[model samples]
Target: MRIFVPGDAAAIALGADDVAQAIQNAAARRGLPVEIVRNGSRGMVWLEPLVEAETPAGRIAYGPVEPAAVSGLFEAGFFEGGAHPLRIGRPEDHPFLKRQTRLAFARCGITDPLSLDDYRAHGGLKGLERALAIGPAATVEEVVNSGLRGRGGAGFPTGIKWRTVAETKAQQKYIVCNADEGDSGTFADRMMMEGDPFCLIEGMAIAGIATGATKGYIYIRSEYPHAVAAMREAVRRARKAGFLGERLPGSTHSFDMEVRVGAGAYVCGEETALLDSLEGKRGQVRAKPPLPAHVGLFGKPTVINNVISLASVPFILAEGGAAYRDFGMGRSRGTMPIQLAGNIKHGGLFETAFGITLGELVDDIGGGTASGRPVKAVQVGGPLGAYFPRALFGTPFDYEAFAAADGLIGHGGIVVFDDTVNMLEQARFAFEFCAFESCGKCTPCRIGSKRGAETIDKIRGGIDPGANLALVQELCETMKFGSLCALGGFTPYPVLSAIRHFPEDFGTAAHLAAAE
Candidate 1:
C-alpha cells in the first residue's frame, strides 16, 4: 500500500515528519507493507499533516494527524481506508478542495515533488512540449491571448511583458522568475515551489523558449529553505532528464537555469530590486525610464515575471490560451490562488476564477474568524493592500474592481481580522514594516515611513488627534507619489484605509462626541 504524507514546509512545521515516521513504525510493528510518499500540500492548511492512504476507492485522507495517534490510526485500519475519527475522506472531495478552480496548482500536493514520472503522469511538461512544437513567436502570442496578469502584486499583463522581451533585439536575453515573495500573509509561491518544483521548472523552460532566452534564474527568498532545496533538486533531476541544459529534447534552442537564494529583504521583491540583488548588488530599486524588459539582467533584454505568472504558463501552453482565458471576469481573466490567513477559521489556499466577492471569501469560504467574532476588516493583497471594512465586503476579487474600491489584489493574500483587532495598531504595523524593510535609497520611503509610524503613535496617544490625523494623511500622499518603489508608495494603503474605515480606532469618535 502507498501512503502519502506532505513534505510541505507548513505540514512539516505541523509535525508531518513525526507522523510519517510513526506510520512507518506502526506498519513495521504490524508487518504491513507500506510505501510512504512525501507529497506537497493540498492547500488545506487547517488540516495539515493530512495523511492519505491509497485504497481502491482512491486516496483517503486523515488530517492534522499527530504522531501519538499513529498506533490508534493503525488499529483503526487507516491504511486500508478504515473508519477513524481523524478521517477526512478523499482530499479532493473536501468542501475546500472541491470548490477551488485550481489550474496552476493542479499538480501541487497531489504528486511527489521529486518524481519526474509523477509530474508527467499529471500533465506536466505538456506545456513545454507544446511550446517547443509551436516555436517562440507563437508561444509568446498564446500567452498574449490568455490575458494573464502578474500574480505577484502588480496587475501588469504577463503577455505584454513577454512580448516586450520577445520583440527586443539582444545578443543575450534572460528569463528571471521573481520568487522573492515578501508580502505578509502570502505563501503561495513557497507552496508551489515546495509542492510542485517541476511545474515551476517547466514553466520557466516555456518562458525561455517563448522569449528566445537561453538562460533562466529563479531568485528564491532565503527564508524558504525547503523551497530552495526542493527547487535545486528538481533542477538537477530536470537537467539529467534533458528537460534543461543545452538543447531540450525535440528542440533546437538551448536553455538552462539555476536557483539563487536572496537575503531576507522585502525590497528585493520589486522587479528592479530583485535584478539588482541577483547581480550581487544591494537590493535597491532602479528608476523606470528603461523598464526591465528593455534593458534587464546584465544589460540585456529580460522577462521578469512573478512565480505565479510563470507557473500559469504551462497550463496556458498545454491547454491553449483561450482555455485558460475562459475562467475569470473582465480584465482579470484567469484563476487566482487566493491565500486565506490570519484570524480565519478555514485558513488555506483557495484557487478560483476572479469575481468571487470579498464577503463570500471572508464568510462562506474562510468560515469567518477563528475567534468566532464578527470580522471587523479584511486586508486583501499584502501589508500594502487596503484594509477593507465589512461595508466594502461586496467588492469583487478582480484587479479593476479592487482598484475601483481603493484597494489592490497584491499577491492575492487575504488576512481576516475579528472585531477585537485595533485598526490603528494594524495601520501602525504597516508603516513600521515599510520603514524596517525600505532599501534606504529614497527620502520619501526612508523618512516618510518612520514619520508615519510616529504620527500614528501620536494619534493613538490622543495627542492633537485631529491635526495628527491630517499630518498622517499628508505624509501618506507624499509617500504615495514621491517614493521610489512600492515599499513607500504602497505603505499608505493600509494606513489611509484604516483611518478611513475605522476612525473610532484612532480615538476620533470620543473627540467628535465631545465637540458635538
Candidate 2:
C-alpha cells in the first residue's frame, strides 16, 4: 500500500515523527508491505499529524493522530484499506481544504514534489511549455491580464514590474523571490517554501522566461531550517530531472537558481534591503524611482517578487489570465493565501479570492480566539499593519477597503488578540520590535522607534502620561514623513491604533490594576 504523510514542521512538532515510525512498525509486524512517502504540508495545520492511506476511492485522511493509534490501522486492515474511524473520507473533501482557490498552491500538498512525472501529471510545466511556444511578449500580456499583485505588503502590480524588466535593455537581469517572512504572524511564504518548493521554482523559472532573466535567487529566512533543506533537495531534484538548468525540457531557455539564507532581519524582506543583502552588503534600504525593475541587484534590471507572487505565475501561465482575474473583487484580482495566526481558534492557512471581511476571517473562519474570550483587537497585516478594533471588523480584507479604513493589509497576516490582551502593551511591543529590527538606514525609523518605546513605557507608568501621549503622536508623524521605508512609516499604525481604539487600557490606573 502507498501511504502519504506530511513532514511539515508543525506536524513533526505534533509528533508526526513518532506516527511515521509507528506506521512502519505496524507494517513490519503485520507482514504487510507499505510505501510511505513524506510529502510537504497540505496547509490544513489544525488537522496536522494528518496521515493518508490510499484507498480504492481516493487518499483517505486520518488526522491529528497519535503514535499509539498506528496499531489500530493495522488491525483495521488499513493497508488493504477499509474505512477507519480516523478516516475523513477523501482528503480533498474536508470543508477547510475544499473551499480554497489554490492556484499558486495547486501542487502544494497533492504531489510528490520531487517527482517530475508527478509534477507534470498535475499540470506543472504546462505554463513553461506555453511560454516557450508563445514567447515573451504574449507571456507578459497574460500576466498583465491576470491582475495579480505582489502578496508582499506593497501590493505592486506584478505584470507591470515584469514588463519593465523585459523592456529594459541590459546584459544581465535577475529574478529574486523575497521569502524572508518576517511579519509576526505571517507564514504563507514559509509554509509554501516548506510544502511546495517546486511551485516556487516553477514560478521563478516563469518569471525568468517572461523577463529574459538567466538567474534566480530565493531569499529564505534562517528560522526555517527544514524549509531550507526541502528547497535545497527540490533544487537538486529539478536539475537532475531536467526541469531546471540548461535546456529545460522542450525549451532552450537556460536558467539556474540558488537559495540564499537570510540573517533573520525583518527589514530584509523589503526588496531594496533584500537586494543589498544579496549583494553581500549590510542590508540597507536604497531610495526608490530607480526601482528594482530598472536598477537592482548590483546595477542590473531585476524582478523581485514575493514568494506568493512568483508561486502564482505557473498557474497564470497554465490557466488563462481571465480565469485568475475572475475570482477577486475590484482591482485586487485572484486568490490570496491568507495566513491566520496568533491566539486564533482555527489559525492556519486560508487561501481564497479577495473580498472577505475581517469579521468573517476572525469569527467565522478562525472560530474566535483560542482563549474563548471576546476578541478585543485584530492586527491586520503585520507589526507594521494597523490594529483594527471590533468597530472596524466590518472592513473588507482588501487593499482599497483597508486603506480607506485607515489601515493597510501589509502582508495579510491577521493576528487576533483576545480581551485579556493589553493593547497598550501590544503597542509598546510594536515600537520595541521596530527598534530592534529596524535596519538603521533612515533617521525616523532608526532613532524614533527606540525613543518611541521609551516614551510608551513612560506612559505605562503614568509618568507625565498626557505629555507622553503628545510625544508619541509627534514621533509617529515624524516617522510617517521622514522614514524612507515602511519599517518606520507603518510602525505608527499599531501604536496609534492601540491608543485610539483602547484609550482606557493605556491609563496609569488601568496599568496598575492589571499589575495587581
Candidate 3:
C-alpha cells in the first residue's frame, strides 16, 4: 500500500510531519505493510496536510488531517479508498483544481521531488529529450513560436530574451533563474522548486542549449530553507544522473548550475539586483540600455528568467510550441500559475488560461471571503498590484487587459480583502513596504516612499486631509516616473487605485477639494 503526505513548508506548518508519524504508527500497530512518500503540496493550501492513499481507483485524498485522526482513518480503511469524513474525493476533481490548465505545475504534486526515478516516470525529461533531439536552433525557434513570455512581472517575451543572448557575442554567457520570490502572497517559484525540481533543472539545461550559456545559477531567497535544501539536493542528483555536469550524454554541449542564496533582500528579486547579489555585491538595481541580456553577471551576456518562465520551456519543447501557445488568449500566451492568498476561502495555487475574469477567480474559484463576509477588493499581482473593486470584476486575466486597466499581473499573486479591510491602510502599506524594501539606489524610491507614507498618515489623521491626499498622489507620480526599478515604479499602482476606487476609505475627495 502506498500512502502520501506533503513535505512542503505549507504542509509542514499544518502539522503534516505529525500526521505522517501518526500514520506510520497506526500502520505499524495494525501490522499493515505500507510505503509512505512525502510529496509536495497539491497547492490546495487550505486543505493542507492533504493525505493521499493510492488504490485501484486512483489517488484518494483526505485533507486538513490531524494526528488524532490517523487511527480513525486507518480503521475506516482509507488506505483501501474506503469512505471517511475527511475524504476530499479526488483532488483533481475539486472545483478549484479542475479549472486550471497546469502546464508548469503538471508534476508538482504528483511526484517525489528528490526522486529522479519518480520524475522520469511521470514524463519529466521528455521536453529536454525533445530539445536535445531537435538541437539548439530548432529549440530556440520552438520557444519563439510558442509565444511564451516571462512569468516574472515584466511579461517580456521569453523567446526574444533568449534570442538576444543567443545572438550576443560573448566568451562567457549565463542562465540565471530568479527564484527570489519576495512578493507577498506569491509562492509559485518556491512550490515549483520544492515540488518538481528536475523540471526546473531540465528547463535551465534547455535554456543553456538555446542561449549558448554554459553556466546557470538559481538565485533563491534564504527565507525558503526547504526550497533551498531541495534545490541543492536536486542539483546533486541531477549531476549524478548525467542531466548536468561537464556535458550531457550524446551531445557536445555542456552546462552546469549552482544554487545561490540571497539574504532575504526583497530588492534581490529584481533581475539586475539579483545579478549583483549573485556576484557577492550589495544588491541594487542597475540602469537600463545595457540590459542584463548584454551586460549582466560579471559583465557577461546573461539570460535571466523567473523560475516559472524557465520551467515552461520544457513543456514548449516537448509538446510543440503551438500546443502550449494554444492555452492562453490573445497576447498573454500559455498558462499562469496564479497564487491565491489572504482572506479567501480556498486559497492555493491555480494555474489557468489567461481569459478568466477577476470575478470568476475571486468569487468562483476562491469561494469568496473565508469569513463569509462580502469581498471588498482584490489585490492582483502582489503588494504592488492595483486594487480591483467589484465594478472592475469583469476585467480579464490577460496581460494586455490588465495593462489597459493600469494593472500588472505581476507573478500572478492575488490577495483578497474582505469588506472590513481599509483600502487607505492598504494604500499606505504599499508605500511603507516600498520604503522598507527599497535598495536606496535612487532618490525617488528612497525618499518618495517615506513621503508617500507620511502624507497618507496626515490624511488618515484628518489634518488637512484633502491637501495631504493631493500631496501623496503627487509623490506617487514622482516615484512612478523617477524610480530605477519596478519597486518604486509599481508602489503607486496600489496607492492610487485605492484612492480612486475606494474614495469613502479616504474620507472625501482630495482632488475635488483641490479643484474647489
Tens digit per residue, CA lDDT, model 2, 272-391: 999999999989899998898999999999999999998898888888789899989888999998888898888888898999988988898888998989999989899898888899
Off by over 4 Å in 2: 80-85, 508-516
Q: Estimated TM-score per prediction?
A: 0.98, 0.96, 0.98
Cα distance off (Å), candidate 2, residue 459: 0.8
Greater lDDT among 2 and 3 belongs to 3
Query: Across residues 1-516, which tens digit of lDDT does each residue of candidate 3 receive?
Result: 999899899999999999999998899998999888989889999999999999999999998899999988988899988898999988889887887898999989889889999998988899888888888888889999999989989999999999999999999999999999988889999999999999999999999999889999999999999999999999999999999988787888898999989997899999999999999989999999799999999999999999999999888999999999898899998999999899999999999988899899899899999999999999988888999999999999999999999888999999999999998899989999999999999999999999899988889899988778878888888989999999999999999999888888898765465345
Which residue segments of model 1 deviate by more than 4 Å?
Answer: 509-516
Worst 10 residues of 3 by lDDT: 507-516
Model 1: per-residue Cα lDDT at residue 177? 95
Q: Residue-pair clashes per candidate, as listed? A: 1, 0, 0
**Among all windows of ten consecutive residues in candidate 1, which has the lowest summed lDDT?**
507-516
For candidate 1, the lDDT comes to: 0.93
**Tell me, what's the RMSD of every candidate?**
1.5, 2.9, 1.3
Which clashing pairs does model 1 show? 40-109
Candidate 3 — which residues are off by over 4 angstroms?
Answer: 511-516
